[model samples]
Target: MSELTCFKAYDIRGKLGTELDTSIAYRIGCAYAQVINPTKVVVGEDVRATSNEIKNAFAQGLMDMGVDVLDIGLCGTEEIYFATKFLGISGGAMITASHNPIDYNGLKLVREDSKPVSNDTGLLDIKLSAEKNDFTFADVKGTMSVVDTTKEYIEHLIGYVAIDTLKPMRIVVNGGNGAAAPTLDRLEVAFKQKNIPIEFIKMNHEPDSTFPNGIPNPLLHEQQAVTGDQVKAHKADLGIAWDGDFDRCFLWDSDGRFIEGYYIVGLLAEAFLLKNPGASIIHDPRLLWNTIDIVEQNGGKAIQSQTGHAYIKEIMRKEDAVYGGEMSAHHYFKDFAYCDSGMIPWLLVVDLLSRRSTDLQTLVSKRMTAYPSPGEINRKVADADVAIVAVRAKFEADSIAIDTTDGVSLSFEQWRFNLRKSNTEPVVRLNLETRGDAVLMQAKTDEILAILDAHA
Candidate 1:
């Protein structure tokens, strides 16, 4: 009866046993196949027990619609993007929950060149078609075949970063027990064969669906400790970790300090601008001060985009942007078909350091101090609207410009803050930054917290 059960603001995510059974997945695939009318579709899955089954069911649906399926079994989300472009497929889908718990699963759909499919695009139509239960199977059913896209993917990734040029550096990598190990293993061997003096301190490299070491989400403080400790203990050049599906990645400096994604955006922007001057860079509106300053200073254009992969990719496509990054650890590249890659950022940074005579901390230290931000703070309240209104109203009376494009962003001469309500959760996310002043940023952050408390 409920036709709007599968669609979400960004992707198709639902519980496993109840809303997201194999039948629903297959029907959704059939609907997608009919809508897109693509000849070839690339499919990939994460490290979950149900992932393969769901993927196969969806493949069946596609095949029923006379669409050939190119199944890249057990690969990361980025690999799906690579396969789509490398094989010139019509589109691709990745069955992954990302950082979600094992009980949940979802599908991230994309068009050719890995164009994201959101509600504004064709996701809503696909959902409606699936719910109607009137799929028109093709007279000639499509066929399916599996292919390993990792070799070409790794080769292309290596081209992005010169592993052979890497210096004798000790690095720490925590796979978090997800899908990162395979790629890392191949990369490690490549680095070794090239005699790029480097050492790998691997933790939780084994992929286990049960997540014995815990769910492979590096965003949580609990999971970040293992990589941070390894960085400190080994005095490694840096630490890298990935989420459940290895789509988004997190990093730590040599000193066991977790570098926020905001600074990394600046770092990568700076690095990319060095080679491609006068290029355009895309960034989410959540954190703008640092990215804007860095991009502009490096002779690159900084474009603000709405949150989510779909919006970012769409904007990048139109603008032909060279790079786009989000503070949430999503990095998109032009060569990668405007798709986010969890493997590219660290490699770029590492290559930059290897070619130069500087350490990771030294490279980012000045920028970190110049534009310090109160790393995204989340507060759970009963009503996110009430909290956002209270915060916005309190700040708007001070002769500041306010915009609600995606959220309430108040800009003052000295400082600015954005308070947005999360669509995926019942919470208000706040990010504030000052003009080279940590004390002022902290003061504004505390003031907003007081308003939140009073309203709560």
Candidate 2:
């Protein structure tokens, strides 16, 4: 048995064969069974090549511990959450590297009610158990059964938004050859049955583990271009794309420009507030001015949170927030067990556009101009902590205020910047936004980059 090194701060992930394999995955399954100790555990995998092997090994390990396994085959990360909650099963694990490279595979585990399990959560217990490699087998092992959640997931998603009186709209979907194609294709079928006014244009809808086009991460400019071109080519109202497991999604305007996730946070906050007025909403601290402005101006309470899914979800459940959003394209809902979904946000966005006779550009265009943000930029460095400390020291001389909810976030009257260490890699991620001043945003970005570069 090899020592485990892929147990990350957030989830278990590593390069295939070297850092992870069927054997290690099997041990993790057993460890999960031990930690969660649920009577039944729901399992799911993405469209990756090694997902099956890992899923099978995990299932075997679960059953060996006499824990019943309900396998929902070939679904996105949120689908597993739905299965676990919809079926009242124990915790579940989704086999995906989530926007990681094709050569990598990992797991996202959650407790019952779709609560995330991070390193500080039950993952530590799982790590210890996997290292020990001791799983006591019962006299009779639990059985494994396959369940299809496609239809149920679709119904649940559509139920969140109005589909009956949806207006006629042309929508372009670019799955980026990840898991979103199958779900979107099925959703298209459902939209057709409802007589909803929607024109569907699907591109790169096939699920290819190799990701021949590129990694499905919409954060990259090149990746966004492919989907943007489709939106312009089809002359569609909006375009949407998903990451590898389809957990978090990205959007493009009718004019083929990538809508920053910060504005989408405001858009969805406004959407939910219309229904449940005065409901609390959680906003990540990284990008906050516009989200706070829109949420408060619209009679919704905005609660600032740290930068990760674990922190966001925990805050949501505690505050009973109606909605939560991260500028990284993660949207969490109170209805969906306070878990993040790449699927629900688009559905709600579609509903918003349909209900109001407005195109995607019109809905978010004003916010973009009002809060022009320098999109997130990352810099590789030998010691990310050193770079962060150096940046903080420079800013401390005349800094207005500083907060380290997730990383180092400095706030000033005109501009603000969040310089944080990446949880998964040896790089520091930077996000800077100004109150409608594009020039100031660029200047702050350049200053931060210089600091990071000097440290590098």
Candidate 3:
């Protein structure tokens, strides 16, 4: 028995072979069964080359412990979240690297009701058990069943929008050869059957385990141009891209400009508030000015939680929030068991555009001007905590206010910024936005960069 490095801050993720392998996966399965003690659990795998092999090992480990496994093969992380709650299972797990490099892979686990088992909640206990690697087979081993929930999942997604109100529009979706291609195909069929006037122009839409077109991350500056160019080339109203597991989706406007997720958070917060007035909307501490402003203006309450899916979901359930959003493009819905979904965000955006009869750029241009942010800027530092402390010391004296929710957020008269260390990586991230001054936002961003560069 030995410690496992695959266990991370919120999930199981590590480089293959050295840090993680089939044996570690099996140990994790055993640990999950021992800790959760569920009669039945849902398991899923993404399109990564080794995902299925690792998933099988994990499932067998569970079966050995007398825990039945429902295997949803070749699916995104959100599918595991959905199946856990939808099937009323005891737990759920997914095998995916999720925008990590091709050589890397990992697992995401949740207990009953699709609640995330993160570090503080239950991951540490699970890690300790897995490291023990002491297990005895049950008198009667459990069974494994192959399941497909694509159609049902699609139905649930479509229910978010009224088919009758959909206007004719063209959308460019760059799947990046990940897990979303099949779901996109199914959604196309559903829309056609319902006579919805929407056309999808897909780019790199097939599930290529090799990821020939790169890892499909729209957040990368270099990758952003790929989707934007396609949007312009196809003259599509919107461009959408997803990571390896499709848990987060990024968007670009008709003018081929990538809209930061911060603005989309505001847009979705307003969208949900339009339907459910006086609802509480959950947002992360990083880049929340836009979200809070929008939520307050729409008769909604914007509550800030520490960043990360587990914390966001916990606060969402605590406050009974209708929606939660992170500037990193993760959007959660109260209706979806308080789980985040990449598919849902784009759906709601499309529906909002159709009903409002406005173009994508026009819909968000005002917010973009009102609060201009450069999205998240991550810098590798020798020590994350030291870097944050140094930056805080340099700016705190001049700051009007300070917040330490997930990271250090300092407020000024016209602009504010958040500096935090990443939970999963050895990097310090910075996010800043201005009330209405884009130039000040840029200048301050540069100033912060200089400080970080010197201190970090």
Candidate 4:
């Protein structure tokens, strides 16, 4: 048995040909089937060049294990989640690296009802089983079928907003040459069918596995300028972009100013809370004041969970939270089987914009002013834990409140910051926010960086 290093905390991802290949994917499928023993499993693939081959191999392995396969070809990760719950399948897997470099490919798995299969849940065992390369074949192989889930998924997304209530608006949508293009096409047709007036200025709207523009990661500052520039060039009311698998969405205002994901969480929370007052909202601990403020002000309960989709979804299910959002732009909803969707967040925001009769900038500018955050900053360090501990020791004395819910979050009277190590990389992430004071935020950010730099 060969070693397998592709499995990670939340999903399986690795460089193609080296750490992951068709054979490895097949082994993973077999291991998943044997471990979970699902009767039927749904499979989907992104627009990556190797995705089809990998998907087919994985399905073959599942079928050999006597597990029926439902292949929903050329879709996003959220679509697989939607199909898994909507079709009542036992399990599902999405073949995607999700904004990783073109040389990479991977899988995101889920159990019944779109419940995530993270390391803590069952991914580690599956990894070990695959490494063992031990499989007992069943006498009868299960059947395979193809199903197109686009229409139903689009309809489900449209339900989040009222078509008639949306005012005529021009928007720029940069699909980043990933899985979002096809879905955007379906959305256009749906809008036309409902007679909703929306002009979509498409940029990088085609799915090209080569990624001519770059990987579709909007979190990178370099990848964001294109969307912002397109929004300005088209004079669109707002700009929206998605990562490779379209599970996360980023936004830019009318003036081509990129809005941080932290603020979007607050905006979306306010939107959901208005619809379902007193509902619970789950938020990540990295950046809290803004989300807590918005949720509480809107008569909603704000619950803090660790920073990850699995954690947020579990907390959402436990609390029956109406919505859960991470500052990284992943938004989960109760109606979507407690899964995250890239399409729904923008639609809800558009509805809010139309109802308010204001541009995206106007809607979020005051909130940004009230709670200024420098966004999340990452530093590559030799030892992330050492750096985190040093920063904690430096700030522990002055902090009015300290919480280790996810990492080291220390709160002061006028400002606060969270310093935590990355789950998948050798880096420390720092997030700072202050009370309506950009200067203070900057100063505190610099102070924290100096501490980090000294240790680095």
TM-score of each: 0.97, 0.97, 0.98, 0.99
The 10-residue segment of model 3 with minimum total lDDT is: 447-456
Estimate the TM-score for candidate 2.
Answer: 0.97
Q: How much lDDT does each candidate structure score?
A: 0.87, 0.88, 0.91, 0.93
* Regions more than 4 Å wrong, model 3: 424-426
- Which should have the higher lDDT, number 1 or number 2? 2
**Which predicted model would earn the best lDDT?**
4
**Candidate 1 wrong stretches, greater than 4 Å:** none
Better of 2 and 3 by TM-score: 3
lDDT of 3 by residue, 1-456 (tens): 667888888898899998889988998888889888989999988898899989999998899999999998888889999989998889999999898899999999999999999888789988998898888778889999998888889999999997899899899998999999989999999999999898999999999999999987888889999899999999999999999889999999998999999899999999999999999999998888888988999999989998889999999999999999998999999999999999999999999998898988998999989888888898888788888888888899999989998789999989999999877677999999999998998898998888778765
Worst 10 residues of 1 by lDDT: 1-10
- Candidate 2 lDDT (Cα, 0 to 1): 0.88
Better of 1 and 4 by lDDT: 4
Model 4's TM-score against the true structure = 0.99
Candidate 2 residues lying further than 4 Å off, grouped into runs, are none
- lDDT (Cα, tens digit) per residue for candidate 4, span 1-456: 667999998999999999999999999989999998999999999999999999999888899899999999999999999999999989999999998889999999999999999988999999999999899878999899999888899999999887778999999998999999999999999899999898899999999989999999998888788789888888899999999999999999989999999999999999998899899999999998999998989999999999999999999999999999999999999999999999999999999998888888987999999999999998888889999998988889998999999889999999999999887888899999999999999998998898888777
